[model samples]
Target chain A: MHKKHNFGAGPCILPSSVMEQAAQAVINWGGMGLSILEVSHRSPEFEDVVLKTQLLVRELLSVPDHYSVLFLQGGASTQFAMVPMNFLSAGKKAAYLDTGYFAQKAIKEAKLFGEVELVASSKDKDYAYIPVGFNNDKHAAYLHCTSNNTIEGTEIFDFSTAGAPLICDMSSDIFSRKINITDFDLIYAGAQKNMGPAGMTLVIAKNEFLDQAKKEIPSMLDYRVFRDNMSMYNTPPVFSIYVAMLNLLWLKDQGGVSGIEQRNIEKAKLLYAEIDRNPLFYGTADVEHRSRMNVTFLAINKEVETGFLKFAADMGIVGIKGYRTVGGFRASLYNALPLSSVEVLVNAMASFEKIYSDKTVLELE
Target chain B: MHKKHNFGAGPCILPSSVMEQAAQAVINWGGMGLSILEVSHRSPEFEDVVLKTQLLVRELLSVPDHYSVLFLQGGASTQFAMVPMNFLSAGKKAAYLDTGYFAQKAIKEAKLFGEVELVASSKDKDYAYIPVGFNNDKHAAYLHCTSNNTIEGTEIFDFSTAGAPLICDMSSDIFSRKINITDFDLIYAGAQKNMGPAGMTLVIAKNEFLDQAKKEIPSMLDYRVFRDNMSMYNTPPVFSIYVAMLNLLWLKDQGGVSGIEQRNIEKAKLLYAEIDRNPLFYGTADVEHRSRMNVTFLAINKEVETGFLKFAADMGIVGIKGYRTVGGFRASLYNALPLSSVEVLVNAMASFEKIYSDKTVLELE
Candidate 1:
């Protein structure tokens, strides 16, 4: 069967070899004659998988030695609440930049713990662009931002590299690019995007950020519980973490983050250029703030949008439907999306333009 | 290669077919030519999986329509905090029955939200037995208990199910029994036990209980979010839930809860009977409060325990080691544990008995 070019926002595409190796471990892990799922997280073998996965993340992003990496559940969504619960103490307020649907969710969650001031917002323009030069409080504990707006295809071009300890929800574009880890106080991402599978949420936090937690919070939700135990607070998502470890190893083998980032830049450029050059389609995300990880565009002729969709569907471009909130097309270009897949999407776009342009001209005359 | 039994507490054993189906879906899901992991949770097909998984859960447990089934992450460990975060309001004391490690964790989390009263406890006896006569408080919001203690090898004979809106953490023995689902207001279990794999927690709650959630809780932790969205508020653990649904369907094919309950009872009886009949082994956990799912036993000859473990290991009886907190041998007979596996454990015990008896006589002289 031909592989489809998957553009899912999350619970997204993973390397084929990672899936195969993961499946093999499901039946019998290593030579232990037991499934990896059956092994104890406390066991040395399972511990190594967790350690190596964290190490790979550290190495990929060049994470500082003072920071800790954690594998959590509930994805980036869970962190929406946990961030406030841990840090939003003393009736103090936190600043958040509103970009897309997830930003709205984070804002809502933070409101429960303490005050959340919307520092900047692109809601007026339907989150079609990333808001910059945010109004933030100097007294605020931290400034939160989503590195990549998954729904809106907007990306932050420049951020406060050293201000109020930046906390980023990098769920969409963590290891896909080379990041200056020291710039952010804490960063979290679900493994489904650019990493490996669902079930594990990767959290990287500075040691000092751990001091923000109040004593009243639950231990499991506390960063200290995970940090102290070394992400072994509970039996982790073993199989997911193991596969993520394999994916990280795979990523490392492919020239680390720098190499992949360059490839991602080129892939997104190829696909976005096809949308820009074609009269049949127009890109949605602001050209200046376009995400390098996701290419979002709308069909130029609304009446023929269904026809374009059908054409793309026939060509095996799956999960290209933009979020309902921002209807059109969105091709997520995560780390696992190879250059070949991007080429395929570009070719599909060209083929659609050739088919639709002739029909549109006849109607206009 | 033979498949060995996996018994590492949570993230434990799973249905063999679930893994096979999950692996297949990674390549192509329902002819979509995309990995199941690559589909958006917002999509209709993924939503179908979510709804169907919930529907089947209701059917399997004979759960009433008033009850809502929620799939969340962080397992029972997170629920420990989430329950209190949601339901603990009005300064009313919630009854916490400290049965074992998980129960104590819940108690610790509850203290953060509101006043929690330790209504009953088994801690005095090192959590080896379920306590008796938990006073049902008319003023109490809920009475929480751990139905089966995975570590302590104890289970409540009858869940204090009828009074004070009973809530139970059935993590270790959820599907291993047939119970009146209506008797409890809430029942939760992590999928690792007998359901499927780890990284997913099954929460079944009365709709009214969800309505009682305090507005102070975070939106992501709100039961209302899951209740309204049918557990698809965010991208779910696609692979984990798919595996869980597959296992649920497989259980239905195996004659549902009633069928599995009978098998669990038989499996537990087989192991416990061998322990009682043989003088070399002594059972942990009180006889009256003995768990039907996990049977923990210690060697009567103190020096021969290691030898017994080695003998059992050599004979291919996996996961026989008891929890380190309560040291001994624990044979967990969860829903996925085949009766044949119990037979293997018993056979290993029978052989070990002969060897220990001969060695003890020589040492006594």
Candidate 2:
């Protein structure tokens, strides 16, 4: 098999062990003679799985006792509307931090419900850095922010919300680092990135936040409904949840979020250091606010960028092409991405730089 | 391995070959070292998968050219709200056929959008029969109905809709029978029972219906957004869609919808025959309206019902217990249930009835 180093932004790589476990469950779950996909979600087997998965999320994130972990569908995009649908009460405005692509999407959806206050924005610099030093309205219904911008490669590692309830969309960089779970009233992540396959969305919300949600919210979109039904308000994405459960088990085995954080740091550092040293490459996002999950850079020119893409592909490096809006290279070093893969990418960059160096110019031409 | 016969209501049984293919994709898809889970949704490989899956659905259902097939997340329950959210225009009420549990859920959500007229209902008879001979309001925006009630074990195999758009929720018996694609303006099904896993919902809507839908619908919940984006409005439930695609392939191999319909009829006939012959068993649904997918029945007595459950468990039957609201037994014979499994269930019923035949023996005990 021709193995490729996966660096896709989301719907990214997962641990082999987790994949194996998921595959096994697809055929015979715990030797029950029925595939996990075949079993009823309400059955005892799946009930245990759902509960155990919630517990793992709690243990890994050090989630407070009052918080509820729900495995939902529709990705983070659905949560954009659901957060406001549930929490943004009548006559109240929501405070939004316009970080990049996703935050803008959230703001657009929130506008359908109530007024939105743009507390801070990084669009002035093409979202090269996370916005800082903005005063938020304390009376706003909730403070919404994207924890990490996958497309722009900017992250908010340290940010303080005003008195309003903090609602974060951590889709792209969850479980790759440690964060105080109690700091936010609600934190949601699409499982495509550091969590699992693309299908399920993980929502960790405080009990009080859910209790205070509007009762008229659609049952499927209501956080309180999901929390009350244990994320089975309706037929959930069973296979997606099973794979997510396996991934969480793998994350726990990998020493939870704290243990994975150190490894992520090493991998990001290796790739960023090479980008800095290599003459052909330059970092796009501000170095201080650069995302550890997705490391974005640009080649000296479009021709060089195209050439480097071919070189990376030939080296079995996959999904490193930058997002369309950001035309460069994006090496997504998610939790499942090993340091060795980053080394291979770094080596590829070094080799390409050497071959295209100014000293060797015009030799072939 | 404990081999249990899965008769689950949903997240139900699937073909072994389909499960194997899905499991293999979890490891190496088309020998491309990356797991199907790892590939980006925008990647050419996944793009092909998504398009091919839509083609397969169209092919299997013989869906017309003017109808768009969408693989969406949030299940049919989400579609419950989305149906009215998009189709129910201002000042136009929707006509709902409240046949059973799921139908009521749909009505409840529809009420949130506009006035709903309950044209017909089976609630008076504990949803034992599909309501018939009722006049529908053709002037209403749309007529919404659940095609098959999974919990109630009743089906509308011969129902006529008003001149308005016919939106049917075919969650339980979709693809298990031959359905006339043009009869409904919109059809949605949760991909758990006869389709695949639970994460995805299959929506087949006439292109014109989508074009005329409310423009203000949320992107994720809007059928037009999904159609315009080819169901890639966001990161879709990837694994779920792939499995559904695989199941569609399997269905084609089993002779598409027609072949599966034949098998389904035979399985239901076999179980119902046993219920009729056995002294202990009596079907709960009206004889004329009994569902071919879900065959609900009850034992002669409460003690016998409890005893048979334990007996069925010892005989390796799983998920045969009726829905909580409707107590007894509900053998969900979905598309994947083999005639042999139904025969086994029939034999178990016969054996149980013989062992508990004497009515006077209970008093002696």
Candidate 3:
């Protein structure tokens, strides 16, 4: 069977090799004669999986020893609540950037715990670009921002925290790029996009920062509990973590995050150039703030939009439909999405443009 | 490779058939040329998966129309906090039966939300039996109970609610038996044991009871939000739910819950009988309260105990080690554990007993 070009936004693509190995492990992990699904989390085999996965995250990111890396459930949505539940003590305020859909969500959950100051917002421009130079409260409990907006196809390349401790939801773009781990106190990502799959969230937080989190909160929500217990305070999403370990191993083989980031940049640049040069389509999001992961674009009209989607589907191009809130096409160039797939999508675009342009000229004559 | 008997307490065995299908889907789901891990949770294909999974649970359990079946993340440990965060209101006491380790953890989370009335406990006997006939507060907001203690090797065969709204954590014994859906206001289980795998939690709650839950809780912890959104509040654990659907289909093929309950009983009976008849072994939990899912037993002495464990390991019988708090052996008979596996365990026990007893005779002589 021909490989379909997958461009799903969050539960996006993964290396075929990772998928093959993951599938095999589900049947017989490490030749144990027992499926990974059936293995006890406490067993030495699974404990090693957890340990190696943590080591990979740390080694790949150059994470400091002071930071605790955790594989927890409930995705980034749970972290929205947990962030404030842990750090935002009663009567204290937390500063937030209103970047896009997820940023707004993080702010909403924080309000349930304490005060939230919206230090900056791009909602005024339909979240088309990232905001800059906004005044932030250094004295606030901590500053929170979504480093990448999966829905709006915007990413923050430049971060300025204004002296406050930084917490970022990097769900859509984590592991696709390299960043200074010391720049933020906490960094979290749901492992669906560039890491592995859904069902697990990766958290890296400074131990001192974790110690400042509120006491008496639910143990499951406590960052310190996971940190202290090596993220095994409870039964983890075992298979998800294992697959993530495989995917990360693949990343390490490709020369780690820095290597993958170059490929990601090339794929994004190739697609964005086609979107700009093609007369039949236009790119969404400001060029400066556009995401290297999710490339949102639009056809000149609805007729062409619907036709192009069907046209792409016929070529085994799937999961390119844009999120409902942002109507149009979103070709996600996640880490696992090959440059070859991007070329196929770009070629499809150029061919459709030629056909449509010729048809329009003939009608005018 | 020889098949190993998997009897790990939780994250236990699944049918080999289910594992095969789950593995295939990970490589190429439904001939889509995309791994299930790479598919969008919002895609129609996966939407159908979530819907069918819910339908299967409803159909298999004969769940009433008033109950909403939801698939959520964070396992049962998260449910411990969510249960009280949603139900236990300020100034209202919630009654709890302290059955074992998990039960105590649930009680701890509940105390963070409101007053917790310890309705009953078997701690006096090291959790060797299920407590019975203890006075309960009917005026409490809700009554919480763990139906099966995975670590204690005790199961509650009967339940009395004392007129309070009933909530049960059936993490270890949910699909192992058939129960009246109307007996409780809410029922929850982590999918690892009898359903599918870890990472997903199955929640079936009466809609009316959900309405009484506290407002202003975090959306992830709010049962009503999940009920309203069809459990897609935020990209539900896609792969876990898909595998669970496959496993549930396997259960349906095996004549559903009641059918599996009989086989589970037979497997439990076979192992427990051997534990009783063997001169070198004795069952740990009270005879009447012994768990059909996990049969906990002790050996005649430390030497024989160490010897039997090694003896069983050589035969590829695995995951039968008992909890440290109650050590000897714990042969968990979850639904997926075939009677053949149980026979091997029983035979091992009898063989070990014969060898040890003969040694004892020779030593005495």
Candidate 4:
């Protein structure tokens, strides 16, 4: 097999070991002679799986006893509507921080339920920096923010809720960092990035906050329904949740979030350091707010960018293409992305610079 | 490994060959050196899988070109809210047939959107039979029904939508039989039963009916959004869809829906014949409305029922316990249940009757 480096943004890489175990379970689980996919979700075997999965999420996040960790469907896009549907009732306004594409998407969905207040926005500078500070509405339904911007590669480390309850979409950067679970009322993440696969969306909501859900919300869209039923209100994404459970086990083995966070920091440092020192490349996001998870940068010009991408592919490194809106390379260094992969990318960048760096290289043409 | 027979109502049995191939893809897809779960949905590999899956569904059911087939997240329960949210605006009514638990749940959600009319119901008999010969409102937004009742073991073979458009939740008996595509405006099914696994839901909607969707629906909940994007409007249930694709391929190899339906008929006939002939057990569903998918029945007493359950378990049969509300046995013989499995169940029932046929059998203690 070729040595491949997967840097795809969302449905990204997972630990190789986790993939192996998940594949095994896909064939036969618990020696029960049934694939995990073939077992009934209500059966004792699967119940153990769902319970173990939830327990792991709570343990990894150090989630409070009053909070419910739910494995749900519809991805973060569904939560974009569910959050506002549950919290932003008629006549209530939700305070939102418009950081990037996802935050803007959330804001649009929130607008459907009631009034929405844009507390702050980084759109003025193409979302290259996370807005430093904002005054939130203390009486608003809740304050919502996307903790990390995948496309722009910016992150907000500070999420001081002040007097208002906080709701966060940490889809891309969750589990790669540590945070106080008590600080937020609601947190949701699509599992493809840091958690597991594409189908399962994890929702951790404080119980009291869930009790405040608007009456008459559709049962499927209501957080209370999912939390009350232990995320079994309907048939869940079984394979996705099982895979996520394996990933959580892998996370715990890797010294939990703190241990992975340290490795992530080291990985980001190695890649960003190479970008800073390389003459042909320059970081895109603001240095202070650059996302450690997704490192976005440019390659001087289109010719250099195209040449480097082809070069990376030739070396069996793939999915390093830049976002459509932003014409620069983006290497998503997610939790499962090994430090060795980052070293390879950095070495590729250095080699490209060594061959192309010259005072009159373009003039020679 | 222990021999096991899975009769789960949903997340039920799939063809052995389909499960084998799906298990392989979970490890490495098409020798791409990436687990199907690890690849991006936008990748060419996953795109081909999704395309082939859709084509198979269309070909199996002979779906019209005007109808768009979608593989979405959130299951059929999400569609409960989405269907009415899109079709039933204020001042309009959606006529519903309350046949069982799911139909009631759908009605409850539709009530949140607009007026809901109970066109017919078998709830008086605890949904033990399908409601037949219902009058429908031609001017209503739509008429909705569940094609098969799993808990009650009833089915409606003739939908006959009248002049109004029909929406069906075919969660349990979707591919187990053949149907006319033009008879319904929309059809949705949770993949746990006859399709593949939990998490993914299939939606087939006529283009004109989709054009009538209400404006301002949440992007994730709107069918038009999924249809327009070819079910890639969001990160779908990738693993479940892939598995369902394999199951669909298996169905085609068995000669599509008509072939499977013939085997389904034979399987149900064998089981029902034993039920009918056995003096110690009896079927719950009315003969006229008996389902070919789920065969529900009961022993003469709780003692006999308990004894037979243990006997079935020892004989490698599982998930045959009846729903709590109904209580004795519900052998869900879905599309993948082999005729030999039905023969096994029939022999078990015969042996059970032979052992407990006498009136003094319970009194012998």
Candidate 5:
């Protein structure tokens, strides 16, 4: 029953305890003798789930009182359209910074809502770092960024501060690090990455940003609709939220965000150091803006990448294959991934180098 | 443990066998040594899950080649918006028949995208039946209907044709019946109900309707994105899809839609007949429009309702409580619910009636 340190991207590894608790709830939830999935979302049992999740999120992230936390259905992918649809009424254009594949998707979704100006993009350099030279467009309704690029293994170390109600798709990095809530009026993440699982998108939006929801907004898509209903407008993925609640509870038990921040820093440091110290492996992301959650690397020789991946897979390791959006290895170290797992991954890498080198030595001998 | 037959609403009952399969997959999926949740959705193993689910759905429902099946996150609630955003273009109005709460929510969402007309509504009778007076708006985008009203226990026995492209929200009663896919251009159901669990929404749309997707639609929300990527535009809810797959497989093994429809018809009949036989309880909804999915009723004496519910709960009956939107008792008989469970409910009802009658006779004496 030992869960392999699961590193699959989104719908990714959850804490063992959270999974166990979630599994139990699926059977006899809160002693109600009903699966959490079958409970009325409006019932006090579920309402408590909604309220406690919001309160815990606020407490963990230090969210301001006015900011609303919505437990939405679609992952951040849905928010890509929603952000502009609800917020794009004021202006004809919105500023978009494409840091990675997901940011590009958000930009594409935003354009459907309004005219999009590409203020900056790192696609020119294969999305290895936060794009530079962002010229602010004051007329733009909001500025958008993806805090952590899951595919490209890069991140925005510090958010751009030109500040037109900064909107960020923090799908991969929220709850992974501490953030100043005041800097961004709207920040959202698909719960899968660091929070819990797929199908739940966690959003924290300022009250002002929400008041901008156009009158004809789709009642279900309307963030305000969720705000009014406390995200129970219609059955809001009860089991997902239930599991997410357990994850948030697990996060709190793990000493909240700050405690994990220190551990994640060390996990990232150890992996990156091994990648850098070894000549057989190559790190992809820019040194200044590497991600703490996913480590991107490649075998120095591309011909053996498949063999190396296979070798890693044979050794109780899985889901480390890089996103096809970027071809290489991506070791996603989310909150539940202990430093021990990172050591396991790093150990495999060192052994990989030794095995390949010794094979060549044996041939020469 | 003894898992009660969960019958709340959508996210209702899942087959115990399916739940057992899900429990097994949580640890080792497809002999992959990783939890199904930990598999890369982009990988071939999970792709089999995504593609095979569509195949099973097509086989089970007899979906045509002209139709495309998609597994998308964001639930049916998100579909309310996507349906309009995509189809309601070209200055055409969309006609939505509001049968109940979710239908009303969908109507409100349609207005956000473009012109929307309330073609029919049951609100006059508190959504007791599918509304009357269908109009053929020659220029309308689609005529939308909630095939089954989960909260009100009302349903359209078959698809309604209003001389426009038909869109149906079959969230609560999709797989329970044999659906004519050609009658509706688009059909969506959140997997919680008869489909499987929560998080995933099953979208079956005609290829022709999808071909008409207007440009500038958010890539993620765009049916075309899912159509093109085969529902992997982003990481799908792998675990949810896997569960749905198992549920569908189980459905097929039990003789597919025809078999399930027969069983469901019988279960609804037996329970409704029992309710009608008893003077103490009368069924909700117009008899002609009653739903086979959720059977709702009220006691002649309001005082007896809670007692009945508590008494039922004590007998391992879960999700018997009606939606607070319309309180009484609702026995949801999704496809996963066995006819034996309905018998369990009927026997409990008879026992409750007997116990209450004896107590009343004692008091009178």
Candidate 6:
């Protein structure tokens, strides 16, 4: 089989070495003569897997002892509801940034629980860039923001809490970059993009912040329940967490988040440069706010857009299609996506450009 | 390597063929040249998987068109909250049958959203049997019950709604026996038992019943959202669902639920017969209400109990430990567990009984 370059967004690529090991573990985990799928979550072997994965997340992110790392299910979408259920009561207000599609979703769920004050919004500009210099309610229960917009191909490079507890949905760009854990009271990411697969959501939150959460909330939605029980309040997504541990081990060998960030930067720079030089194509989203993880771009016309997609597919370049709302192409350069895959995508663009340029000259004649 | 017999209560055994296919798909799914772990949930390939799995569930169970089958996250624990959040309001009372540990848990979450009336309970007898001959409130919003008590080793053989809609938590005994889908307004099972892995939950509910659910609930917790979106409101648990589809396929090959039910009966009879005949042990739950899925038993004495467990372990029979609250032994016979494995467990029991009987005679001498 030929090497296929995968760039799917969320449920995205993972290291080949990790995939190999994960496959083997599914068959016989730790030589226990049992498939990981069939192993009891309460078993010491799986418990160690959960513990080791949490430790790896802590070591990789430099998480403080004051914070708890939980591997929960229901993805970040569940976190959208859980964040409010835990902190915001009917009387209190929560501040949220309306930067893109996901941020708007977080705001929608928060509204179900309490008052939501929009701190800043880039919705007016189609979420092309992050908003700046907006004041947040210091007295609000918490200030929520999305660190990266998977759909709009924009990222938040800077964060401000404005005296409120900071909660960020870092779903798309979690392990792709480095950030200080102390700056935010809570951080969550669905483990598909940079972490592992789609079944688990990773949560890192301050223990003190959790203490103030409203009492008598649904236990499954309560972060305190998960924190107290070590995320074993129920049978967790065992295989997903196991695979995530393998991927995290791979990330650590590649020198952790800081190391992967450098490579991600290089890959993004290469792809964006080609988009700039290619006459047949133009990059979407503001250049200043362009995502290093998901690079959104468009062909000059609809004909070229259809033509180039087919041209690229023939070369085994898959999962570069953009989001539905944004009708162009999105090449997701998540952490596991190698520079070589980006080079293949860039070459596909260059070759398509040359063909289009010749056709345009002929049509002009 | 020896063939190990797995009798885990849940997250137990899966077909060996299903595990093999699942492991291969993790590396290269359907020869798509990409790991199933890395594929987009929106892609045609994965959409087909979700569709096919739904179809298999519908076909295997003969699900009616008025019902929707959903593959969701958060397990049945989440369903415990969602059931009341959707149907039960603060003023409305929901009737509950407190059968065992999991039934109590479901009742606890429901109380958070509305008033709960305990129609009947077996807790007075340490939940050794399912409650009987109790009348539920006909005017209650819904009647809730657990079909199987995983911890206490009891299963409900008969269901009655008392004119209200019926909802069941069938997490541990979902596919092990045939049940009329039309009998309940809703049925839910965490996939770890008879279905698949731990990351996904399977929900089957009547569309008409869901239409009456409360409006403006959090989208993720709303069954209507999953039904409308075909369980794709967000990225589903890809690998878990894939493995489930494989296991469901294996189940279909074994002649669907009715066929497996016969084998399950044989397996249960073999083990329960051994427990009844053996002088060193006695069954835990009431004889009539004893679960075919989980057969709980205890040794006559503590020293003999410890010795028998070690003896079973040495013979490569695993996951037979009972629940903490009900200390003894529990050999779970899920759908995928073969009768051959049960024979090994029975042989181990017989061999230990012989040794214990000889030791008793020697002590008397």
Give lDDT per model, in order.
0.82, 0.89, 0.91, 0.88, 0.83, 0.91
State TM-scores per candidate.
Answer: 0.97, 0.97, 0.99, 0.98, 0.94, 0.99
Residue A261 alpha-carbon offset, candidate 1, angstroms: 0.5
Each candidate's DockQ: 0.65, 0.78, 0.87, 0.75, 0.50, 0.82
Model 3 ranges off by over 4 Å: none
Task: Put down candidate 3 lDDT per residue, B1-365, tens digits, no spaces.
Answer: 99898888889899999899999999999898889989999889999999999999999999999999999998899999999999998889999999999999999999998899998899999999988887767788889999999988999998755578899999999988899889999999999999998989999999999999998999999999999999999988898899899989999998999999999888888888888888888998998998999889888899988999999999899988899878888889998988998888888888887888888899999
lDDT of 6 by residue, B1-365 (tens): 66578999878899989888988988898898999999999998889999999999999998999999998899989999999999997678999999989888999999899899999999999999998888877689999999998888999998855578899999999988888899999999999999999999999999999999999899999999999898999989999999999999999999999999999999999999999999888998999999999999999999888998899999888999888889999999999888889999999899998899888899999
Report the C-alpha lDDT of model 1 over A26-91, residue by residue, as the tens digit. 767887877776666777888888889889988988988999988888888889988988887776
Off by over 4 Å in 2: A362-365, B1-3, B358-365
Looking at model 1, the pairs that clash are none
Model 5 misplaced regions, further than 4 Å: A1-5, A90-92, A132-139, A160-162, A362-365, B122-124, B131-139, B158-162
Weakest 10 consecutive residues of candidate 5 chain B by summed lDDT: B30-39
State the TM-score of the second chain for every model.
Answer: 0.95, 0.97, 0.98, 0.97, 0.97, 0.98
Best by DockQ: 3
DockQ of 5: 0.50
- Global CA lDDT computed for model 2: 0.89
Q: Model 3 scores what on Cα lDDT?
A: 0.91
| lDDT, candidate 1, at B223 | 79
Docking outcome class, model 4: medium
- Return the TM-score for candidate 6, rounded to 2 decimals: 0.99
**B242-302 per-residue lDDT for model 1 (tens digits):** 8888889999998999998888888888989999998878898899989988788888765
lDDT score, residue A242, model 6?
93
| Candidate 4: tens digits of C-alpha lDDT, residues A100-155 | 98899999888888899999998999999988657876898899999989999998
* Global fold similarity of model 4 (TM-score): 0.98
What's every prediction's RMSD, in angstroms?
A: 1.8, 1.7, 1.0, 1.7, 2.5, 1.0
